[model samples]
Target: MNESKFFWQACRLLWMSGILLVLISWGSDVPVSTAVSNISYATTITVDSSRDVSTSLSERCDTHTPCTLRRAIVQARLLAPAARPVLIQFDIPTSDVGYDASQELWELEVKSTTDPAVFRTVEGGQVTIDGTTQPHGRVDGPKIILVGPATGNKNGLIIGVNASGSHDNNIVRGLGFQNFKDHLTINSSHNTIEDNWFGLTSEGQQPYLRNDNPQDGSGSAGVVLISGAEQNLVQQNTFLAFDGVAIALRGNDNTVRHNQIGTNALGLLTLKQTSPSLLCTPEDWLGGGGISADGTGHLIEENIIAGLRQQIFAISTQPDAIWVQSTCTSCTIQNNQVGVDAEGHEVGVCGRGFYLTNTKQVQVIDNVLAETYHSALFLNGALYDANTLRGNIIRKSTPWLIPDDSPKGDDAILRFTGLPDPLEFFNPAKITHIEGTTVSGTAGDGSPCPNCVIELFLDDNDNINEALESVAVVTAKADGTWSATLPTPLADGFGLRTSSTTAQFNTIANISAGTTVGLSELYMPGYVGYLPLITR
Candidate 1:
């Protein structure tokens, strides 16, 4: 009996051991699936100075090592390549903690050596980098996104994404890039920058970099540098107090529309390079203007540019504004309004309505210039043939002198050759006379004279001869007065000749040198017929 009981106990122990081994195997396999699932996964990276870095908020935070935000970004880029839509949230104190106006939070260097196909999505972070990071170098990249905080103190987030032949197909949305030094240079193709607040202060330095040195003066510009980028879209941005241009574009086949660019030294400036020698100068640079396109086959339309000291200066600023040097061809500046001030004086100095220089095959149409200090359209240098200026409303105002030249008011329409006066042929005061005249005869008394015969003659060949066929008849009234309403003839030549007579007069009196007698009816004798004159 004892041996049988012992056998039962041994069997029970073996079963229990088998169950424990099964649990151990299951635990070992579960970890492998968990590690594999994390590959190419979407993750959130949050940066806060107060939180302990070692805390395992997620699987990403494994250690407590102190790392810079810029380093964290580099790691994220290396770790995740296929996983899309990664968000980086920045929780920095506005007034006290990590908010250092003197120092930069992040600086991204884009150069030609960088890969153009790597796509990165960056959001909700601040970056500060000066020219010293890599002085005199260009930053290039493709597809970088920058996002800002939703609700916090208005500390003015600053970020610089300067690229040269790099940033193609990238998007920058929802941030206040204030006091950014140097130009937010972009020389890439197919990039979009929209929905950001940009503030400017001076004419030569960026606003964000201006705080670095009190003496190293640079202009505050919203978006200054652009060259050789194609099909870029810059829309829905606010540029305030910028000394340089709000948006300076120098690429082909780009669209800049629907942006509120104001309160700058100069609004928008565009450039194109013929030989690449006639680009903008250091002194000619102003802080205001909105969206100037200086490359061939580009479009600048439907943008609100106001309160600028200088509105739109499209001169040969180094690279040029449309066509480089003298080869700007096939560009269009249409449907834009300038010179409407939101505040300040009714008239502002250092302002230009729209300046065009050395361009061809361009069209400027459907623009309204109201209360400006200079001419609505200033065409300088050599404007080529086949260019058009139509449907523009220029409001009338007193002349304001810009340096040596006095620009006509908003309503002034000017077309000049060389340095001659533009108003010689386009005189606004000249009255245009219509087609025929009226004649009345008086009776021996001072009463009305009816039944008067009147002769009509063509003044010049410039008049519409075809129009005379429909309404070219006149009859004397009861008071010896007659009136005629001339009709224009149609191209088909099927219309009536006159009301009074079917006979057409081929020749009439020559009134230029007064009246002369003994003149034959100037006609091709047998070609057409006319009524013989019956003298009263």
Candidate 2:
């Protein structure tokens, strides 16, 4: 082809590709111009405390006029995607409702009228409800929102208004959430819940969840994250009496960092027994521990846990400060302080600092845990490479502390049994289903690796590394399986299908070229953690 002709052809190809990208973008609910328009007006709406108020439609909310917090949220939603973000700011040191702000401390309440009684709901992207407006707050000053030695509201702040902000930025910061059944329940991704207080009234009173089951200490859904919520920042928050499972996560890659969690209850929780994939309600969240987490690739770090158990004001079982399950793959719980000085200050009411189980490549490192009823760290049945458990400090509480020290068999730092070796290969499963020219699978142990990748290579030279002749790449389902069709369909053998995300014993399939694979011939790579053992 002539130079001029070739240049035009290349330009046409580029133009067509750009048009295709635009079409794909247009397929979504948001348009580029719409998002740009939203970038303009940073609408700051204010609320005057109106108790039990709600918004239906055509209700107006803005700084010029006064509206309830709920009504402001409704108005914000209406103005979003055009404004891109709508900030909800609390009025000065007081509200229209009788929230006596006599001492520079402002307060309000969101009582539950709904069946499960949620205080308020937040959704959408790029929305911020900042309570720190200099006078009301400071970067390094006293917290202004107070509960005045009285009680707080009844429910919690639900953060998934029908799955809004599932992929955008939504932030709630610097507010004191007190006496709610649970503090914050987040079911969206990339949201930030930080620099806030939970479980304490304005006057720094411990807010107790109406614990229905005191005997077992099971009640209240602390902070919850579910519905595939990923990469959220829950940081620098404080919790008072409403601990035992202060935060519950049922999602992937959500970060719980730099928060002051735990007062009289376990700090954080993540369970799969009742909660499952792509589903889990805040109501389904279980209580227990400062960090009771069960998921893949979560980073829990630098949080202070003072008392990882709910005293219940009665006889009850205490939980760990940090709890991890085996299903948690490559999760790191690190660099956290879990106790205080012996002057009636410390974490764990006879509870462990770390209780880990069924975890994969989990690291429990560099935590100072004291004043516990049991071992500081307890490990049971999980996959651990050199990456797990190092540089930790465990010591007994001083004399005259509550919960008489059981120094006999449980007051140690590290305890483990029946744990899986890092390189151990066990019951791993993968399933494949054909969808048009694409193939997908759910890949992992019994649990799921939600956003796992699968790669197919045409080179079946039996060299796992060298077979880089690219074919196709596919992602697994929420269940951790994967499938990908070859560049060309073969009957079966001589191709390779591998879980691109692998451990020491990564699962890779050696397809019989010219032969079609159905479910799979579960791979047994030489080395799973990184490179194949053979190559090494």
Best by lDDT: 2
The digit string of per-residue lDDT tens for model 1 on 1-536 reads: 12222332332243223211111121112111111122232644453332223312222322334433343344344343344334344443434233323332322222111222111222222211111121111121111112112211112211223334322443444334533432344545655555444653223122322343322222244564355667666654556434445666676777665455553312332211112132122332233444555667777665556545332334412111112223446776665555433222223223556666555567665665554444455555533333445444444334323334433322233333432222112111100123223222222122222332223222112211111111232434554345444344222212211111101111111111110111111111122332332111
Best by TM-score: 2
Taking all chains together, the TM-score of candidate 2 against the true structure is: 0.58
C-alpha lDDT of candidate 2 relative to the true structure: 0.49
Q: Write the residue-wise lDDT of candidate 2 on 75-161 in tens digits.
A: 766664667667776655344443444434555555445345343356566677766642443333123342211232345566666
Estimate the lDDT of model 1: 0.36
Which residue runs does candidate 1 get wrong by more than 4 Å? 1-69, 72-81, 84-167, 200-220, 264-291, 310-328, 341-349, 400-411, 416-536
* TM-score, one value per model: 0.47, 0.58
The lDDT per prediction is: 0.36, 0.49
